[model samples]
Target: MHHRGFDDSCGLECVENGHDSNKFSLLCSGSAVTYASFSSQNESKAKLASSAAPDSGATKGGSATKIAWEDTFEVAMQRARTEKKPIMIDFYTDWCGVCKQMDADVFPKKDVITESDKWVSIKINAEKRPDVAGAYGVTGYPTIVFAEGTGKPLSVIPGYSPSTEFVGLMREARAKWKPEAAA
Candidate 1:
């Protein structure tokens, strides 16, 4: 889903007191909107979202090649530090239908995958890693933060973009990157 706006406070007001709680809101801008609650008859989106990371087993346009997302946030940072590359952090939730759509349509696009190589890509499950999401001030699902290797955000894609648009977005992030900015 596209984000109306990000909260200055990092937009994490909806995080539940407990990790296991199924109920939580996705606060965006000034509006507090909740994701649809899963009912008994419906297949549980919460279960799917909570099951695994989005990048796991993901391939590029049904090809054998895989998009290289670092296994963990710590690892991605380490790679970025060494590689002197920026970071592309995809902040998403399991129950978010739009997030899944991007995973299927956008991320796997040849251009997106190719463009992604220039950055250290990481996928952080917002529900699973609320701390990280809060730190980034993410107010919506599929908030893609483009940051310096040192983890300073320079730009953000707050919602879904198609393959063509996403590729350009990636380039824009790379262009905005300053190697010495973090120094």
Candidate 2:
């Protein structure tokens, strides 16, 4: 099948051909579109570390605060449990403009990256992972779900938010997280 490139205005370049297994594959510049299960803890860690580089616009020392996004929700949950940090799931769709804006403009900011480092970050394509999206009741694009290390949700913020606002929401969610409530 012939796959045309995504809109250049969106800053995504894809010459995709087809899907692989249950995961959708798109070759985009500086973006990941695979959702395969991780084989081992070491492999997962290596992947996370390698992909945690600061965005090109980031200044010196920004890499230290970069958020390491997991490839899958399960991996994020496992990492959260192991690291005793909260899980922040970013539910987005490739076609959602706001989602793309968040990816391009908001998430790359230094503050957002620094604050997000405290959590186990996971980006899920809602359209590709309908089951997971439905389970979280995500009806819109760019839904940010904050949960405990055990995967029990703490707060759900819907719609697109600027980097500062998003960080504030994250802080509020973290403050409200109750470990006992998850049990």
lDDT of each: 0.69, 0.65
Which residue pairs overlap in candidate 1's backbone?
10-137, 49-94
Instruction: Give all TM-scores, in the order shown.
Output: 0.68, 0.63
Q: Which stretches of candidate 1 lie over 4 Å from their true place?
A: 1-53, 58-64, 181-183
Candidate closest to the true structure, highest lDDT: 1
What does candidate 1's lDDT look like per residue over 98-122, in tens digits? 5776776677777787788788888
Q: Which 10 successive residues of model 1 have the least lDDT summed?
A: 36-45
Tally clashes: model 2. 0
For candidate 1, the lDDT comes to: 0.69
Residue by residue across 1-183, what tens digits does model 2's lDDT show? 534445444343333334522222233454543222234333423433344322223332225645667777887777777777888998887555456656665787788888887777888888889998998988776688999988778898876566887889999998977654433
Angstrom error at residue 36, model 1? 17
Looking at model 2, which ten-residue stretch has the lowest summed lDDT? 53-62
lDDT at 16 for candidate 2?
Answer: 39
